[model samples]
Target: MPRTTGIRALIRPLRQALRRRISRWITRCCGTPHPRTGPLPAPGRILVCQSNSRLGNTLLLIPLLQGLADRYPHARIDVVIKGCVHGSLLQSLPGIGHVHELPARGAAPRAMLKLIRELRRLHYDLAVEANSLSTTNRILLAGCGASHRLGFAGPDQCLRLTHAVALPSVASHSALQLLHLLTALPGRAPASQPTLAVYPDAPTRARAETRLRRALGSIPANRPVIGFFTRATGNKQLPNAWWQQWRAALHAGGDPPLLIEIVPPGGLPVHADQAAVSTTDLMELAALLARLDVFVSADCGPMHLAAAAGIPVVGLFRATPASRFAPLGNDCISLDEPLHPVVVARETVWRYDRRRDTRRSA
Candidate 1:
């Protein structure tokens, strides 16, 4: 056993060294010239590389897109995304010219090659790598054939970018980090409040309304519709018991808001007592959230979606930091520390009532 352990330890260092050497070689071959200080040229075709498949990561690009639109009003912005669902979401937003969907999983060498050819043909004036410091994305930016490439400069990856900006010492919000990609450009104003915006078409909204009515009865105009998203991907999911307790507390409190549980497609069922509606389509989900008076969720994609829909959201953060991942907007409140179910219930009710009062006053 000791001999095996010693051999394993020796091999681990060897593997790391090999990885470092390969990384260095790739950087040397692909790295662009060091960044020059100057105002950006008028760009006609802009390519943004953000290939992460997670919904939150995709939604975070809204602010960056808005900023780019403001700075280069004439530029046709195209995005390279990983998942089709994210592409669909991006398609709904204004200012987006085209969405280039890359497969989130599995090998698609031919498809990728085709995509590269298409990108090269576009003759993009500027290519921005908006994801974290990733070598693969840097290589992809280099292949886009844009004379100007922008990205963050890590110790080993700075050479790959024509314009490399240093990341902030403290971790900033993901949206802010993405916006920083434009800092080197002249006359680029900072983006206004970073918020996700999803616009569902009439048919999609009608479908969502019909589904909600079928699942949770007709909505009463006077009653506040409260929506809850109890499931999240990975370890970010809250326990069923926790949700049950929260529901019970809400019911026990004074007149409870009309509760609707948003169950993601293929997600675990909510408690039988809670009204649940499940949908696979992101735009359909956004449509439903838009109709709600208040939405409560953990730090997840849907939480950001609800915020985008302009619904009041009480975002609960357990594993993730509230500062970096919390839903943004005036109507949103992020609670990071553990709180009693009754306290959460009370806060939910208060927020609902406050909005109600404001609407009446207005």
Candidate 2:
């Protein structure tokens, strides 16, 4: 067993070296340098590559998209993303012209070739790789044939980019890290606090309201509606018992707030008696989130969605740092340490009450 372990350890560095060599070869073949000294030209066609499939990462790109729109109002901004759900969410964002969905890894080679052809046909003036240090994303950016390519100045991928921003030595929020790419563009202003903005259409809002009415009965005019998200992607999930305790405590105070469980399409239901709403559609989910007075969720994609819809969110974090991944906006509260269910319930209620008071004062 010791011999086998030693052999495996020796093989790991060899594999990494081989991969790095191949990446460098590909970049040298496909990438060309554009001048970095002069002021950046106003691009007519822009391609933003964020090939990560995780929903949270995709949602975080909203601020970068907004930044690009502000910098170049006339550019036709296109995005190359990994999932159809991400494409749908981005479609409604202002200044987005097209959303190109990349086939998942191990998909048919023909599909990848077809996507490459389509990207080349656009003849993009500029391409920005939003991921910090992804070899695959770097390769895609190299092959995109954009006149100017922007990305981070990492050891592996810096040579592939025409203009690369030096990555910060200290850790920062993912949204702030992505905004670093914008600094490479000449004449672009410094990015403000990152916040996602999504606009759901009227028809989608009507449908979402109908679904909510069916599940939770009539909408209360005066009572605060609190939305709870129980499931997260993996180990981030909280136990059902934890939620049950919180729900019970929340109701113990005066008149109970209307609790709506927001479940993802294939996620487990919070409780048999709880009013749960599940949907695969992004806009419908956004529409539902927009109406909620407060949203309580784990550090998950839907948590970002609720924040984007301008709802106050109470984000519970256990595995990840709330400092880095907490929902944007002043209305968000992030609890990183373990707190009692009663405490969580009270804090959520207090946030809603404060919001109400502020609105009244306004």
Candidate 3:
């Protein structure tokens, strides 16, 4: 029985390999073909697949989904999300149609096959695999029975996609590049800037405002709500001396500081009258964020969330290239600097960033 189990495991891997090899051979020989629906008729249905690695990555996908809908207004756009929670996020986000829950990970062979069968029954006109091309993604796209498959590919992986967008350098923001792929297709070119829309309930907004009021009691509201996100990769937080200097600067300028932190239900180092909240719940976070006039954060998920919410953001970026992570909005500011022999001030924020050229007019 033990030997039989071992043999069975080996057979499964071998079978997968053989299937992959066959799929590749077919793609290389015949070349991946576009949808054969005769002409440029409107697609019946479209599926956008999610296999992104991070929260910011997933958030960036919003515009691409919007662009797809804009281009194919008649088509029912469905998103295959990686989890039930992920599907819920997509459902809450604007510009989404149907949200199909995918496994928390990649679909198993049997599961994938079943999904393909279900998709076939729906008669999808196109499937856009919006992830890095792997043997699995290639197989999934080829096997899904969609007439068209689109993806970004390099010189080596070009053949696997029916229509491949030229993958840009890693320095470029993946979100912007993804938008290009949608626009560069056979339809109308995409808009100049992609935007995300969110509508927070009034009560939630009020609650968030009440919390902020308690945190910054008697502080002038117009004094540039300079939020400090004191966490980053490997403790890029502001030291006591830095805070001391910050306090000195603010006091000299008649401004007050409002320190934000995660508290119970998420993380806690609770203190009195502090505007603490959880990051785990989007609704709670959204409420807290809606109350902020301006937000400052590290190059983390919260930063992207703030940008998506159309809030003015200032991001302190280190290690990662700011190009890929910077919030591309007029109100958002990205400051790229190494955590060093510390020099931090309002001036320091502007000095470190090349993008901060358009100074706030006096």
1 or 2: which has the higher lDDT?
Answer: 2
**Per-residue lDDT for 258 in model 3?**
52
lDDT score, candidate 3: 0.60
Clash totals, every prediction: 0, 0, 0
lDDT of 3 at 102: 52
In model 1, the worst 10-residue window by lDDT is 30-39
Whole-structure CA lDDT of model 2? 0.82
1-362 per-residue lDDT for model 3 (tens digits): 13456778879888988866775566557644332212345676887776554666667777788888788777788876555544544566545678765544545767777776776777678788777555445555666678777776553352445566666677878677778666436777787676554455677667666666665665553333444454454544445454445545544544344555543354543334345555455554656765555666667766776676666677767666778778655467677775332334564344223222322333
- The lDDT per prediction is 0.80, 0.82, 0.60
**Model 1 over residues 195-276: C-alpha lDDT tens digits?**
7788899999999999889877977766788899887866577787887888888888567778999886765557866778
Could you give me the TM-score of model 1 versus the true structure? Answer: 0.90
Q: Which residue runs does candidate 1 get wrong by more than 4 Å?
A: 1-36, 266-268
- N/CA/C clash count, model 2: 0
lDDT at residue 208 of model 3 (Cα atoms)? 66
In model 1, pairs of residues that clash are none
